[model samples]
Target: MSEWDAEFEVESESDEDPDFGPHGDARIDHAVASGTFTLDGQTFDVENNIWVVGDDAECVVIDAPHDVTEILEVIANRRVIAILCTHGHDDHVRYAPDLGLATDARVLLHPDDLPVWRLTHRAPPSGSLHDHQVIPIADVDLRVIHTPGHTPGSVCFYAEEFPGYPAGVVFTGDTLFEGGPGATGRSFSDHDQILESIRTKLLTLPDATVVKTGHGPDTTIGAERDNV
Candidate 1:
């Protein structure tokens, strides 16, 4: 087993109901769960959000944190088409390979983060995500926005009028958070780059755009625009 398998634990499971929208095409169900893991002797909490779009039987998974069991349970009976990582952080991607294998789903990451991914995962991802790339999951088309800084390959997935989200939703991995942009104290992290990313890529979105962060509660593009 990889060190990831031995070091992480599913601390809890909390299921939130999917937000329903007006049109059937916009009706996407989603659930969020969290897991805990230790890296370099420090414990970190990670959140994994699963989105069920189109036929409701097919789905896309974002940020494969620890607790594969919980993630599996959340996606039970559904066919996962893709596993999209926001970046290459171990805390966010530790279970991606196993989860992808279990679901036979394609794993995707930014090419710039391949080195970070190689630090923990032995195999390369199924593909690479680039700016403005559109990922079709069921009836939804998630637009990839490459927001570097937190990591060279950090990205955020954006979809408009998704389910209960009228304005839109952006799955911001560790790049942009509720309070401010993600930390830049680690290797390959740049404060200026992250700030510029937030300004040009994220903050430019509509004010009401929902910011589904990788680790905490959601925020809006407007809320963090001032901070940026």
Candidate 2:
């Protein structure tokens, strides 16, 4: 067995919740680590869901929030490959530099959102993510689906038949949610563009595909498809 497999075997046997999802050779575990902080005089409750999707000792991080210490603790000894920002939102991208510095991971963001990203972040990302870009992590591949609306560069990460996750998973930043699409009242947001992006990019996925949002509880594509 591989080092990761050995670690998982010993850890899974004793751990009940295991911070894992699905169940099979390809195990993808996630922990929803949240933090409540005041940003721009507004008290924002951020739910940062960090996913560890791979079999090897190395892994990838999706969306770095303010509470990075918790995320780092959850990751434990695994090597973090990259820190992918779903959008340029300050709430989501804050502390990304700290996390990157701590983990020695590359930070990635969409090109269009750089302006908004710069509002809160001073340093540039290690790289930029484009539409249909595939990010490989051991046995899993996270497909980047650009769903601009919440922001000009907002993107979602999609994975098909990811080990323990059979229906697949989509890490939707602020582009989508349970009740409806993400809010577009901000300066760079557009309502029509967001609706179209969801209809074309997200709703097209299989009904069972899991919708993992940047905040709040998780939902399935089927549950929000008709609403879109």
Candidate 3:
């Protein structure tokens, strides 16, 4: 049986799932560790995950929420190495500079969303993030997949062996979700593009690949596939 049976009071497969814990934890090992914070008047469950593959300790932040103070409170103790933006929404990027200032970590983002970054008037620790670009932080190697659905610069970070699933996991941001996927409503975002990105970038991962989204709860490629 899946880990769902261990922690959750899931009655049946038909029962509605609340919170992203089950799928989220399945992707992140209990030892992996995570932190939560609120942003944009909304609460974002930010996960401060550490990886072991390099000399120094490295971490990856799923979404840069608007509530910098809360996020700071979340990972106050851990050493952050990198910041990953699920998409270039105002709420998500609002705290990028604040977090960057606090952690001194490199900010990773797609070139297409540079406009959103520019609005902040802050330069990323590194530079623009590209599709399929593999960046190394502390001890983590994050593979960037430009999943532009919510925005043109949306991307997901994938790391192998850091979480429960041996094959690794993917951070869906706003592009993909537990049941179906996120909507593409921005003026610049193309509905067709977002759909295509999921089909190619996210769903292409192994069935066991867990999806950690920007908002709401978490789901897996396998679990969502069955529903889709």
Candidate 4:
């Protein structure tokens, strides 16, 4: 694989090279949960991606999805720093509070999405997530970006300076996908705002940066740069 390893993740070092990137030992676990998503008086069946980032000792769970049990299984007794909410959409953060309570971790979300968030969840999030806020996992970082096109508080976490991905990786939530930007036809979403967010916030990243989405498959910045 090239220096910008976009696909398969290497667990250990090769004979040719011994050094892994910063916190190269870190692990990213993926799981999916199925449930109903409700927003703008519309409900649809959806499957949300549960991303566990960090090492065996401590990690951060991104997006609680439907089932807390599914997310906890991926967590597997690890110390969870926070249950990070990429957006306040029902499909993405449905069980955030449950997972946070289960793991004894804080549930964090961007305040701007509170209107949408309050529609489903009565209990508030543990705290607020601001733009450019840094979520530390081991030695790497999940840098927050306030990409508000998908929703008023939609954000993406850009993981970088870690092992394998010298070009870095991005947790797009619902802001971007393989074909183009995420849906904006719903309420509190604007086509022009989403286009601007994709153009300025996401498209500016490195070409090889992997795009991990809220749903569907993963793509890279380079592959999506021209399309967006």
Candidate 5:
């Protein structure tokens, strides 16, 4: 049932990293949305993970894939401060504009991925996301880490420390995944560059740094360091 077809498949929401419960200091929520991903004249079905980070009052939604309703449902009544796209891939940013419209929140994407972004959306991004930039959520912040190769502007959001929450977590799009980096064989993607990006940017984080990905289950930097 957790698929993104016309049905807008809805799965039972999963809790944040077990340690970071809904009421826990981490204050994160997660959902999976499905839809077809189209690019370079080809399209395939995909299921993407949607990350919501905030407290009782407000929050930020990450990777607005398939369903805006689902995203909003997860957001509940909290004020949506922003919609952050890890990259400009259609699946990740597809529902961003819809979500922004529904919540009156700005949608942010790195400038470099505009070309890919335009393949799906005509209007430019609501705002730009840049390297080392700090995105303030309720209390903690996500420091941008520009890790291209999945797309020229692919980036990750690293949340190091916030009161009451565990330190060291990164939100990686398709640049890196559980086993290793995802498909670079696609158009506009690179193999070596992504590996290098992972090497210098992500792997350098602490071993316990949790890697919140754009698709599938969560992973850790330490679990991926030796494998990738």
Candidate 6:
């Protein structure tokens, strides 16, 4: 990948990567049950958010974020059945191996994002995911939507009725966000392709589908479509 394609050089990396860019609506709320944790940056400058699902019996973590110890401490109270990645960004999977070892949970991702993951961890995706594939992670039933844009294998996980909520929820890694979508400046990334993916794959979901973004606060498909 060229410098322009892989360069996500923000001035300073934080627990959260700044705030959501300009593509967000002021009215929609961005709150969800996903928890945040920290991690160490050995191979890369790992900095991102982590999300957790499930209640007392079992739970699944979305995005490793950074700081393995912190992530384990945060989810220490629950039984983690699996770990899922939206994409293979460094910050997203820095602690996945340790987390999976700690919980003995299966680590899963799209086959396409495996290369990106291997660049950091030296291994490919533990599992394979295809578009419209439904994966049951403990209590969470995730439908993998391969909306490649930010990366060739970029995907999002959607639950028709996310645990306690009546409306469906989508875990949009770096693909579809509140304000707009992820950057598609790489050789593998196509601007028109990502746009079309969002318009057709994501925007077609229910209006009330709650979106738990990879970086910033959560929003809904309806809001982004309307705001844009």
TM-scores for all predictions: 0.82, 0.83, 0.68, 0.88, 0.86, 0.74
Question: Candidate 1: lDDT of 176?
Answer: 83
| C-alpha lDDT of candidate 4 relative to the true structure | 0.81
Provide the clash count, candidate 4.
0
Best by TM-score: 4
Residue clash pairs of candidate 5: 4-34
Total clashes in model 2, counting residue pairs 3 or more apart in sequence or in different chains: 2
Arranged by TM-score with the best first, the candidates are 4, 5, 2, 1, 6, 3
Query: Weakest 10 consecutive residues, lDDT, candidate 1?
Result: 8-17
Q: Model 3 over residues 1-228: C-alpha lDDT tens digits?
A: 224332223432322223211111222321123344433355545543322222222345655665566665555565664666766665566667777878876565666887656654466424455666564444335577888766788888776655345667777777777777676554557788888888877777888877776655667887876543
What is each predicted model's overall lDDT from 0 to 1? Answer: 0.75, 0.77, 0.59, 0.81, 0.81, 0.66
Local error of candidate 4 at residue 187 (angstroms):
1.4
Give the 10-residue window scoring lowest on summed lDDT in candidate 5.
Answer: 3-12
- Model 6 misplaced stretches (Cα beyond 4 Å): 1-47, 138-140, 226-228
Query: Please, what are the lDDT tens digits per residue for candidate 5 over residues 5-54?
Result: 11111111221112112333447799998898988889999999989988
Candidate 4: segments with Cα more than 4 A from true spot:
1-24
Per-residue lDDT tens digits of candidate 2, residues 155-220?
999987565567898889888889889987767889999999999989889989988888877899
What lDDT does candidate 3 reach at residue 130? 63
Expressed as tens digits, the lDDT of each residue in 86-157 for candidate 1 is 999887788889999999986878889998898778998876667776666555667889999998999999
Using lDDT as the yardstick, the better of models 5 and 6 is 5
- Per-candidate Cα RMSD to the true structure, in Å, reads 9.5, 9.4, 13.6, 9.8, 10.0, 12.5
Candidate with more favorable, higher lDDT: 1 or 6? 1
User: What stretches of model 1 exceed 4 Å from their correct place?
Assistant: 1-55
Candidate 4 positional error at 168, Å: 0.3
What would the per-residue lDDT of candidate 6 be over residues 1-228, giving only the tens digit for each residue?
323112212211221112112221111122222333222332323235567765545666887766667777667676676677887766677778878887887676767877677766886545555676555544445677888877778888888865445678888888877788876665456788888889989998898888888777678888899643
lDDT winner between 2 and 5, please give it. 5
Backbone-clash count (model 3): 1
Q: In candidate 6, residue 167 scores what lDDT?
A: 79
